[model samples]
Structures are given as structure tokens and as C-alpha cells.
Target: MGAARTSDRRRRRAVPWVVLGLWIAVLALTSPFASKLADVQRDRAVDYLPASADSTQVAKIQDRLPGGETTQMVVVYHRDAGLTEADKATAADQIAEIAGSHRLTGEPVGVPSKDGTTLMYPVASNEPGIDEKARDELVNDVRDVARGGDGLNVEVGGEGALATDAAEVYNSLDGPLLYTTVAVVALLLIIIYRSPFLWLVPLFVAGVANYLSMGVAYGLNQWFGTSVSGQSSGIMTILVFGAGTDYALLLVARYREELRRIERPYEAMVAALKGCGPAVLASSGTVAAGLLCLLAADLNSSRGMGPLGTVGVLCALVAMLTLLPAVLVLLGRRVFWPLIPRYGSTPKARRSLFAAMGSSAGRRPRTVLVGGALLLGALALGTLNLPGAIKQEDSFTSKPDAVAAMETLGRAYPERSTQPITVITPADRAETTLADIRGTQGVDSAEQGRTGGGWAEISVIAKDAPQSAGETTTIEDLRDKLDGSYVGGPSAEQIDLKDTNARDRLIVVPIVLVSVLLILIALLRSVVAPLILVAAVVAVWGAALGIGGLVFGPVFGYEGTDPGLGLLSFVFLVALGVDYGIFLMHRMREESLNGAEPVTAALTALRTTGGVIASAGLVLAATFAVLTNMPMVQLVELGFVIAVGVLLDTFLVRTYLVTSASVALRRKVWWPGALSKEPADPVPPKEPERVTAAAH
Candidate 1:
């Protein structure tokens, strides 16, 4: 027995070093792949669009055309007071210079606006083809040569230029997003722990987990040809820090409590794992299941996000459960410094914020429940104010050069569209398609441009502004008029993106709700409890989106909303919000099993787990809040909604509504489970017989 105990202690001492060594090896292997994740990320509209969408088909067919893919640009030269003789001469000279430099599809034709204030030179180049770097360089060269002076304004505007500008914003997100998220998490941890050294452990572990998730993401992309974009990768990074830190907080809090009871750090960590492991596992599993529900979506980005998000969460889970415990055990109790939990020493007793909250909730369960529901319902009403799908020019928080040019075109050409709608038809029917497109109701002008790969491309201009209702009607009319032809362009892509998102919301939201509810039911073994949690998270999601609706346009000055915002935010909020609910309900269930009354168990659970849940929620919310400071409006809106939802869930729903509901429901909260039934009265233990001094 003595040898067994000594051997166990030795093994425990050796385990930390082994874990550290293994992690170092894993990091070394994964670092290369992590570094390469950026190379495979695709951010084109086609990359995000549904595979069967007409716009997606057009884009794919264009790539197989004569020159692979053309880089089209329109050089807009405008003067508010109309072009003078010298202004025309200057425009002519610049047009000649551009034409001489690049291989344009046709001669530079300057289309003067009816008001004579704007002159746009239609320029198309097959030189750069499908090479993104080359395309951006070409656009930059055109912008450099097409500069204006005095009253004149020259702007480079086209699909190619807009893509380049958007790409810059997405590419710039990775470094700053990671740094900001790490900083926010670190600050929150320092405040929560109030211990310098203890905070670093979890932060460091989360960073490793982030790196590992990136490597794994890249592997998935390479192996399965999974679509990855700057959007999905950025969200993945947020999850790594947000969800990883959450798991760390729960583990650390439980470990601290155990340290005061158990003498050895190893034994205490084991006890901590036993205490909180099921809840952590169940929570992460719930999140992963919810994210995976996105696979049913038709949109390419949404489908790809399902796996990438799950990778981030599962990576965080593994790191928190393994690397976190190993490090904490190795560091032992002094890692907490001034607030070190000493074995056999009583902790300082004080009233906690959650305790006061639980008391109010316990005292007036029904009132609190109804009041919370009313507040959520009121907040949800703001969804009516949400802006429509964002347009290209309104996508950025700050106006980019392409957006500036597009705006100029929009103002100058109010009677006709500056952007061309592309139509691809079978090569055999090229002439018929071109004639049909020209005869279409909304057609301003139609021209045959490129023909190759068994398809012919036609550029058709509408008699209305880009993305306007009239232009949409024109595109629809053209689509109806021309059979077996794929009609597409920037506006068409936006239309497809918006429609697909709406469809995805109907499909993915239900899947996420059902999957999460089922997981909760299995974890809690109670239908009513799971229903309450699902309803609470759904309310939180609505309230969060409603907050976005109230603030996105009015307060933040955003012009429109991203098409995917509704579906993505719902998935994230419901999945993450339920994590706190799990912590609270699981603790409440444990207390009930230990023979405490339902109301007593509910209050005790709240008082015990509330602080940890609050801390975790704050960490998660803060990490997401970092996205609000990002450059793109889509990222900012997403970050804001999710952050707001987390706070509401943590402080309001989990702490108040859930506790009160449990109290009100009493044993019925655990109905169909053993705890729902009444137990027999406790029997006194038999007293031992006393021995006389003579007997001894």
C-alpha cells in the first residue's frame, strides 16, 4: 500500500513534464500548417455564393473563358461644372496612355454622360486573368495614371477594383483581430483573477489552442477542399479565445475550491475535473453540435463555417481539459499568490452579487419570470428597424477608393447603369442570346464581348442605377427573356446572397435549435428544463438582434446590414448562451441529488456557480466585442450583436430568469428523472457499543 501511494505520487509528478513536452512537439508540427492557412482563404463573391446560383455559375464559366478571367475597370473622369476643352484633352491623353500600356479587349471608348459632367472610359483587360495579385496591381497602375487635378475628379471603379479594396480590408483583419482579442481577454482575466501569474496560464493555453485550430482548419481545407474565407477564419479566432477562456475559467474556479479541500495539487485537479468535467464537456458538445447544424445551409460560406467553428470549439475544449489542468497542477497553489487557497483553511465568507440576485429571484419567482419575459419581448420589437441587405458601396465602414468612384458614377449616370450585367450563353446560340438581351425591356445597351470554352459573354447595361429596384427588375426580366443563359454581375451576386441567407435562416435556425435542445435534454434529463433554456437563448438572440437594429444604423451610422447577420448571430448566441445555463442547471441538479429541496438547490447553485459564469460570460463577450472595432461593417455588426447577447444572457437570463423558473417549477424542473420523486425520511445511524476499561 505504501509503495502504491509512493508510485502514484511519482507518476503525478512526472505527468506535467510529459504533457509540456507533448504540447511542444505538437506545436512544432502544427506551426507550419497554421502559417499556411492564409494562403488558402478565398474571399470572392463566388466563394461565398451558393453553388447552384446563377451568379456562381457565371463566375465559374468566366474563369474558363479565352483569357481565364478578365479584369474589367471603368476609369471615370468627372467635373461638377462639366468638362472644359482642356479637361476633355486631358481625359483623352490619359485614356490613350492607359490604352497603350495594357491589352484592352477593344479601343477605349469614352461614354459622355447626358449632362456632360462625367466621362467614363470602358476598359477591359484579359492580361491579369484570374491572378488576384496581378489584377490588384493592374488596378493600382490604372489609378496612379488616372489622377485628376483642380476641379476634375478621376476615380477607378469596376468589379476588379472593388474586389481588390474589399480584399485589403479582409486581409488586414487577421493580425489586428488576433491581437485585439488577446488583449481584451488578457485584460478581463487580470481583472477577474486579480493575480498576474494565474491569468497568463489560461491566456497562454488559449493561444496554443488557437494556433492548433488554425493548423487543423488549414488541414480540413486542403483535405476536403472546404471553402475558407477571411470571415470564417476571423470568427474561428474569436471562438478560440472566447470559448477557450470560458472553459479555463470554469476549470480554474473548480480547481481553486478543490485546493482548499485536498492536500495535493494533482489530487485536487482530479477532483476539480470530476466536479466540472461533465458540464464543460456537455457545453462544448452543445456548441459544436449547434455549429455543425450550419452544414445544412445552401450557402457556401455558411456550410464551411460549420466545420471550422466546430474545430475551434473542440480545440479549445481539448486544451482546457488537458493542457490547462497539467499546467495548473504543476504550478500548484502558490500560482494564485496573495489569494492562494490554503488546504484546511476556511475561505473568507462574504455576500456575493449572485447571492443577492438569487435571493430576489427565490422570493418572487413568478414576478421575476414574467418581468424578464416582458423585457425580452420589448427588446425583440426592435428587429423591425433592421436595415436591408448591404450594398457594395455601403459594405465598408469608411469609403474606399472604389466606393468613391462608384458613388460618382451613381450620381453622374442616373438615367442609365454604369455597371454592366454579364450574361453567359452557349456558344452555338450567341447571336440569338445577344439579340434577345438587346430586345429585353430594361436593356439600355447590349454587346458581345468574349466567346470561348463553349460559352459566349455579353455585357448588358440597364436603364437604371446599380442595385436599384428598377435595375433588379431589369435583371429579372432579362433572365426570364433569355432561357439557358446565366445572368450575373455584382448586383446579381448581392441578390443571390440575400436570398440564400433568407433560405438558410429558415433551415439552419431550426436545426440549431433542435440540436441544442436535444443535447440539453440528454445532459439534463429533463424536457421542461431544456425547453426553458432553449426559449431563453432564443429570446436572447432576438433581443441581441433587436439591439443591433436599434444601434446599427441610428447610433453606428451604418447604411445597411449584412445578409448573413441574422442566421450567424442566432447560431452563436444560442450555442454560447446555453453554456452558462448548463453550468447553473447542472449545479442545481447536483445539489438536488444531494437531498436539498429544489428551491434551496436552485439558490445554492446560483450562489456557487454564478461568479464563474459571470466571469466566463464577460470574457466571451469582451473577446467578441473586439470585432466591433474592426474595419468592415459586417464584422462590426456581428461582433456587436453577439457581445450584447452574451451579456444579456449572463446577467439577466441565466442569473435571474433561469433561477426563478427553477424555483417556481420545484421538483417538476427535474420531472421524469429520479430526483422528481419524493424520498423517504432519513434514518438515524445505530450507535456503537461503549467498552468498559476492564474489557480493553
Candidate 2:
């Protein structure tokens, strides 16, 4: 029986390499097809366009209309007396010259402020264009011209310049951030494992998962005509490396433990897989489900992120289960060459801290449960004052183009720098047309132009700046009133204007919450379990937001929260927190079926799992902390909040909650079946004895 069992273990251990090879082949063959697939979709989408709806027709109509290329850049020229009419005219001329020279297809119109203190040049893009590279060149060229020999302190600000600057900031930080994160994680892993080869193992596996996931994401973009932006790229890197390393740690840690039990290396590998496979699968399933829930999001960008992130996680899981095990099998015992521990013939016995804690919790269930609840409740208090703001101006680093543009606008034409509100009134309605729109509340100025045969475009500049949510609300109310009061237009006639800020917030919140909830339920396999998990997740999210608001709002003078923060917080909390829950629950389940009693089982599980969970949490937290080195405010906030949340989940929630729950339920913890009502213990298999050769 022993020989047969050993043979069976060897076969199982060899299977993963075969699977890894197959996956590698699939990734290779699929990579080249990504570009081809994208081309096919692009061609089909282009061909299906209406004949009258060509790009030229759209461009011509937009240029001739008031709100066609309604967005503008504000150029702030500061001097002792602000700007005289002569100075304004010269600035305008200089701007126009630069625009013309640089092939800037925009209507450069300069208007001095009503106070006559600042000059504002509102340049509208003729092509409705905002290209990062082109905009950067235009801004730089304009800056050079405006500042040269004029002795005029002039600054150019607008969406184009701001976006270009933000991109530059990101580009500057990307290489350093990537290297730093990789280096930090590598060093941390080495410290924990105390093995150079083991450190490389996780890094190598994560790299494969990262690259393959990127290839898969490219394929997804090709198939769906989705744009994968820089944000998504950063997220892809974090997810693939952080999550991949996590799974590797779990598997390798178990492999080492199993090695201390079995003599043969192959037997140990198979034993480790059998023990760790289910836990890894559950953890991966939760993460994948959470990310996949992004599909339900209203925003195209976020919806794209769902599948992109999910692919990375799934790839990591596949690599951990297949490639990682295969590598271990091939390396055999040499993988841990220098650090092999001396072992006796008998299995060693040692009391684990997690086991002690679990035992205590099982003995005193109320204490553990109540204590945990109180801690979470206290943390959740910060959430009550949670503020949700999506300020694009604040999303990037302080040095980003967007921030510079906003600052320039605030200094120059604060009113005009604000985005214009487009009010669509039916042309057929004489009472609600351009003339009527000019008379509406808060309208500083109104420009009307024909959009089509029956639709009139009314562009209204607000009395106040448009960055605030209050401004957004005012615009929304104006639209509602216009639509409801104007009955003389076509029944289908409606207002369609983009609220970039509000649209971002609305799309991010539900998508993140729903995605996280789905992932929790999939992992826990109980409806109640997911609900509680999500509640904890929400608490963590709220805490993160509150902390961010306080730090950014008060310390940095950032007035409001960046919308991207909410979405990022959601993903990070879910991914990292779920890992904690998975680690704890895995051990909890194992103990419930193996330990002598419910209390003993809880104690044993905690002792065994607590150390690993803590180690994994520290690694993940440190990995996220690397984001602090990024130039972007969003990344910094995301890194800090996620790191904090991981620490909380790992040390406080996972340790206490699982222990308390195990004790409270006792035998009933298993529920409906009680795990067969057998005493929790590992039943040793009978060993076969060989017959004596002399007697035979």
C-alpha cells in the first residue's frame, strides 16, 4: 500500500508541468492574433458608419456650432496691473501665431476678465481633439512664445495642456515605480523565505503571469474595441505581481511544511498540492468573480478594467497551480538546498501562536466575537463622514498638466475656465430657443447655433466656476427644467451633455461594490458569508476615503476627493481583504474536520494559519506601499489605504472573526451535515508490510 501510494503521488506531482507547457503554448499562439483581431473590429466599426455621418461632416458641423468644440484652454497672464487691452491683444496674437505655426486646429479667442485684471484666451479645438503628445508640444511652444522678451508672466492652462502634463508625470514615474515595487517585493520575499532561489521563483512566476495577462488584455481590447489606458496598465502590473506572489507564497509555504512530513520530494509536492489546491482555487475564484463584476459598470473605461484585471488574476492562479508546481517538481529538494532542516523519523510537534489563539477563542467565543465587532465598528466610524468627489484636476500629480491648467484658469478667467453647459432646446420651440436660454438663471453668456434641422445648441457659461458638485447639480437642474417646460419641441428632443465628473462617480461606485460582493460570495460559498465580508470591505473602503479626504483636503489643500480614488479603493480592498479571509477560512475548515474538538480545532487552525496570513499580509501591504513613490495622488492614496486595509484584515478581522465563529457554532459550524459528525482528526492510512524474503 505504501509503495502504491508513493507511485500515485509521483504521477500527481508530474501532471502540473504538462499543464504548464500547454498554457505556455496557448499564450504564445494567441499573442500575434491580438493586433489582427483589433484591426478586424476597427474595420467593421468604420465600415458600418452612415454615409452622411462621415468624420468630415461631423467636423464641419462641430466647427460651425457653438458647443461643437465647446471645451477651451485658459491662458493666464499675470503682471502688476494685470492685463491692459493692448497687452491682451498682443497675448492673443502670440497665442494665435503659436497655434497656427504648430498646426493647432483651434479657434483662439482672447477675452479679458470683467475686472480687467487678467486676460483669458479661450482656444477651442477645431478638430474636437486632445492628443497628449501634440498638446504637450503646443503647450511648450506657446509657453516659449508667451514668455519670450515680453517680460510678461504668462501661463497656459486648459484640458489639453493639463492632460498632456498628467501623462508626462505618469511617464516619468512609471519606470521608477515599476522598478521600486519589483525590488521591494523581491527583497521582502527574500527576507521572509531566506532563500535566494525561492525569491526568484515568485518573481519569475509573477512576471510570466503579468506578461501573459497583458497579452490577454490586449486580445480583449481587440475583441471589444475598448481602450486600455495608463490607469489600467498600472493596475494590471499591481494585480499580476501582488496576487501572483501571494499564491506562490501560499503554495511554497505549504510545500515546505509537507517536506518536513514525507521523505520523498515528489510525495511532499503532491501532498502540498492536495492540501493547498482547494484554498488557492477558492481565493482565485473570489478575486476573479469580483473583477468580472466590473462588466456591469456603466462606464466603458471601468467595464474594460473588469475583464483586464480578471485575466491577470486568472492567469496568476493558473501559473501558481501549474507552472509553480512544475518548477518545484523539477527542482525537487534542491529548491531549498541550503536551508534544509534536520528532521527526526517521527513528526515534530510544536505549539503554534495561531493554534493558541484559536483555542482561547473556542474556549471564550463571546470574547473574541465581541472584541472583533468592536474594533471593526470603531474603524467604521470614520466612514460616516465619507465624501465622494471626482475632481479630474486633482486626479493627477501636482506637477501634471491638468493641475497646471486648472491653476492657470483659476488665476485668469475663473468663470470662463469653468466648463460650459450645453442646453439643447428644440428649434421648433420658439419660446425655449436661444433667446429664451440667454435669459435663464446663472447664465453669464449664451451662444446658440444650429446642430441639425430641428435641434439648436445653446452653450451657457455659468456665473460661478464648474468644478464643484454644486455646479454639476445646477446644470442637471437646468437640463431637467428645460426638458420639462419646453413642450413645443419634438417629443424625442432631449438634452445630451457630458458631465465628466458626475458620470465618473456614478459609474465607479456600484461597479466596485457589486464586483467585490460577487467575489466574496464565490469564495465563501455562503450568502451570509459574502454579505459580512462585503460589509467589512465597505468599512475599510469608507475608512480609506475618510483618511484620504482629510489628508488631501486639509494638508495638501486639495478641496475634494478624486473620483478614481473610490474605484481604486474598492478593488484594492476586495483583492487584499479577500486574501485574508481565504487564508483564515481555509484553516478554519481544515481544523473543523481534523481537530479533536471545536475549540481545539479553532485554536489549531488559527495557530497554523495566523502566521502565514500575517506574513502574506505584510508582503502585500509592502507591495502596495511601493505606490507611495508614484507621482500621482491617486496612486499614493490607493497604496496607503490598501496597505492599511490589508493589515487590518489580516491581523484583526481574520484572526478573531474566524476563531469566534468557529467556537460559537461548535459542531453546528459545519451546518446541515456537521462534516459527517466525526471527531476532527487526521486518520492515518494503514501501511503495507513486506513479507520476509527468507521465509518466501
Candidate 3:
């Protein structure tokens, strides 16, 4: 039986390499097809906006508008002395000449600082609205011109230009991020295993997973005709590294444990797989399902993020199960090498700190339950007074064009710098009947423009800043009041903007929450588990928001909370927090089924899984912290929230919840119905005996 089992393990270990080879081949075959798929879907979705009545009219208006570039570039000049009239005129001429040479469209509008030490020139793009490539080109052109003159200190800033510059910076940083994460994780694994072959094996599997996941994402994007943003690209980098390392750790740890007891390498590999496979699958399923829930999001960018994240996690799972085991088989005894522990029949110690906590929880169930609940409640209170502020100024570092443009706008035309909110009435309505929409409640001003036909564009400037709670309310009310109102016509048309904060929020939050809940329930197989998990996640989210509000509102002098902060907070909190919960719950169940006392099992699970969770949390936290480097307060807040949330999950939720829940529930911890009969407590596993023998 031992010989047969050893043979079986060898075969199982070989399976992953074969599967990996096959995946490579499949990738090769599919790589050529992606462009074709992209072309077809791109063409189909290309005219989505054109088919709409309002969009068609808007497009026509945009085409005819002078300096009709969708992007605006601002040039800022700062001097020790106040700018002379000659200085302003010279700067204006330089801007105009540059614009003319570049074939740009807008006239230079200059605004001097109140203190007279700073001057800004706002230049609109000359070409009919710029696309991504054109926007990038215009930014570079403006930068080149602004930096060329000898006597002036100037900086160029604009949303379009800045986004372009940021994309470049992100691209440069990506390689370093990937290299650092991979190198650190690989080195850690090497030190843990003390084997060169084993150390590199995980990296190889992760590399395969990364490439395949990217290929899959590209194909999906082509099929869906959606754009992938720089944020998604950054996310992919961390996801690939973190998920890949995590999966490898679970498998390697199990494989080492099995080898000590089983006596044969192949048999040990098979046992490791049989033991750890279900847990990995469960963890990945929960994560992938949570990510897929993003599909219901209203924003195209977020919707794209969902599938991309899901694919990365799923690939990680596959690589762990197949590629990892196969490498173990290929390496055999060499996998552990010079430091291979001696074979032993006895198991390690059963009673651990986790077990003690669990036992205490069982003894004082109300105390454990009530204490945890109160802590979560206190954290959640921070969310109530959360501010909503979503200005683009909060999204990037000071070095970006976007930040520069915002500052210029604030200085030059604070009143007019607010984003225009276009309220569309049906083209079927008579254009001559109604007045412009500028002076409506909560509106600063309104401008009316006519398309070639009956369509009229009403651009409403909000009295409040964009993405503020007040602006959100104002936009919501405007949509309700203007839509379906009969204005000089019997039939009223709908009023809807192509993009608005209210529309995006309503669609994104529910979709993300529902999808995440479904994933949790499916993985846990208990309705209660998902509820608790999500509730804890929500508390973490609220806590982050409250903390951010406190810091930004009083210290930074932010008027209100940024709206995008809410969306970003949800993503990091739910995605990363759920991961820790899944890790804890999985190990607890494993120990329980293996016949350890419920409290002992919980403790064993914690001691074993705690280190891995801590490491993963730090890596994830560091990744999020990178956002703090950006000049934008929004990104700063997001960085802090995610970083703090992960810390809380690792220290508070995982430690307390796992021990208490496991011990209090005892045999019923499996819930629904017991998956395994209660086994008599076996003799505890011994560590010293094996360690002494391995020294031989």
C-alpha cells in the first residue's frame, strides 16, 4: 500500500508541469487571436454614444465649437517678483505661438494671482476634441514649449495632459514594483524551504499564471470592447504577486508536513494536494466571486476591473494546484534539499495560543461575542459623518498635469472652473420655447447651445463643487425636475447626462456588495458566515472613512469628503478583508476535521496561518501605500484607508473572530450539518522527536 501510494503521489506531482506546458501552448495559440477579437468588438461598441439623441447633438455642438479640444492645458508662471505687464504679454504670446505651431485651437486666457506673484494661462486644445493619444501628445508639446524659454519659470498643467504624464510615470514604476514583489516573495520562500529549486519553483508557476491571466484579460477586453485603465494595470501587478505567493505558501507548507509523516515523496505530494486542495479552491472561489461581483458596477472602468481581478485570482489557483505539485514531483527529495527534516509518524503540538483563546470564548461566549460586536460598532460610527468630495485634484501627485490644471483653474476662474453638468431635454421638443437652464436652484450659471436641428444643450454650472454631497443632491434633483417636463410641447422627453456621480454611485455600490456576498456564501456554504464577513467588512470600511474624514477635514482643510473615496474604500476593504477571513476560517475547519479538540484546532490553525496572513497583509498594505505618493488628497485618503483596513483585519478581526467562532461553535462550527463525525482526540503531534532524528 505504501509503495502504491508513493507511485500515485509521483504521478499527481507530475500532473502540474504537464498542465503548465499545455497552458503555455494555449497561450501561444490564443495570442494571435486577441487583436482580431478587439477589432470586431471595438467596431461594434464604437458608435454606442452616437445612437443616442443627446449624444448626437452634443457631438455636433462639440465639432463646431472653437478650440473644440476635449482637453484644456494650463501654463503656470511663478516668480520671486510680481509679474510685469510685459511678462504677462510675453507669456501670452509664447503660449499662442506654441499653440499655433502645434495646430492647437484655443486662445490664451491669463489670470494673475491675487498676490501678484503668480500668473496662469489656460489654453484649450485646437484640434476637434482630443482622444487619449492626442491628449498625451498635446501635453508633451506644451511641456516642451513651456520649458524652452530662458528667463521664465513655468509649469504646464491640464487634466488631459496630466493623465497622459501620469500614465507614463505609472508605466515606469510598474517594472520596479513587479520586480520588488517577486524578488522579496521568492527570497522569503527560499529561506523557508532552504532549497534553490523549491525557491524558484513558485516564481515560475506565478510567472505562468501572470502571463496567462494577462492574456485572458486582453481577450476579455477585446470581447467586451472595454478600456483598461492605469489603475487596473497597477492592480494586476499586486494581485499577481500577492495571490501567487499566497497559493504557493499554502501548498508548500502542506507538502512539507505530509513528507514528514508519509515516508515517500510521491505519496506525500498526493496527501498534500488532497489535504490543501479544497482549502485553496475555497479561498480562490471566494476571492474570484467577490471580484466578479464588480461586473454589476455602472462605471466601465470598474466593470473592467472585476473580470480582470477575477482572472488573476483564478489563474493563481490553477498554478498552485497543478504547476506547484508537478515541480515538487520533479524535484523530489531535492525540493527540501540540505535541510530536509527526518521522516516521523508523530504530529506536532496541538494546544496553541489560538486554542486557548477559543477555549476562553467557549467558556465566556457572551463576553467574546458582545465585546467583538461593540468594537465593530464603535468603528462604524465614524462612517456616519463621512464627507463626499470627488474632485480630480485628489487623484494624483503634484507632479502631474492634472494637479497643475486644477491649481490653475482654482486661481484663474474659481467660479467657472467647476465641471459642467449638461442636462439634456429631448430633441423632439421645440427649441425656441424654453429659456436657458443656468439659474435653476443650486446652479451658478447655465449656457444654451443649439445643434444643427431641434436639439438644445443646457450646460448647468453647479453652485457647489463637483462630487460634493451637495452637488450630488443638486444633480439628482435637477434630473428629477427637468426630465419628462413638457416645455412648449405636448410630449416631454427624458433628461439624462451621459456621466454623473449619482448615476455611477447608485449602480456601483449595490453591484459590488451583492457580488461579494454571493462569493462569500458560496465559499463558506453557510448563510451566517457570509453575513458576518460582509458586516465586519462594512465596519472596517466605515472606520477607514471616518478616520480619513477626521484627518482631511480638520488638518488638510478639505471642505468635505471626496466621493471617489467611498468607492475606493469599498474595493480595498472588501477585497482584502474577506481574504483574511477566508484564510482563518479555512485553517480552522481543517484542524477541526483532523480530530483535534475544537479549541485546540482553532489555536493550531491560527498559529500556522497567522504568519502567512501577516506577511500578505504587509505586502498588500505596502502596495496600497504607494497611492500616497500621489499629490491628490483623494489618493492619499484611499491609501491610508486601505492600509489601515488591512492592519485592522489582520490584528483584530482575524485573531478574535477565528478563535471565538471556532471555540464557541465547537462541533457545530461546520454548521448546516457536521461534515465529519467527532473523532476521539488522537495523541498530539510531537515536534522535538522529528527535529532530533532529522539531525542524523
Error of model 2, residue 547, in angstroms: 4.4
Task: Show where candidate 1 strays beyond 4 Å.
Answer: 682-696
Q: TM-score for each prediction? A: 0.97, 0.80, 0.77
Model 2 lDDT tens row, 1-696: 778766776676657667777867976876775334223221111111222222222333434554343334556665556666567667877887867775433456666666666666656453333233544566676667765235555666665555556556655654676687688779988888888687887788787777677677777776676546555556767777778888888888888877666655556667788888888887877777767766655444455667877887888888887788888877777777577633323335777666666666767778877877776666656554445453556655555544654665665555542455545555576345556555656657867644554555555676766555455545554655665322111001111112222454576557666766665555444454555556666666665555655565556555445444566577668756776677766666676544456566566667777877777888778877777767666677777777777877777677777568766866565543444266445555233232221211
RMSD of 2: 6.6
Per-residue error at 562 for model 1, in Å?
A: 1.0
RMSD of 3: 6.5
Clashing pairs in 1: none
lDDT of 1 at 399: 89
Pairwise lDDT winner, candidates 1 and 2: 1
Q: Write the per-residue lDDT of candidate 3 for residues 182-224, one digit (tens) a residue.
A: 7666766676566767778888888777777767767777677
Per-residue lDDT of model 1, residues 385-493, tens digit only: 9998889889898888889999999888888998889999999999999898888888899999889989999999999988988999999898788899999999899
Q: What is the C-alpha RMSD of each candidate to the true structure, in Å?
A: 3.9, 6.6, 6.5
Residue 568 accuracy (lDDT) in model 1: 96
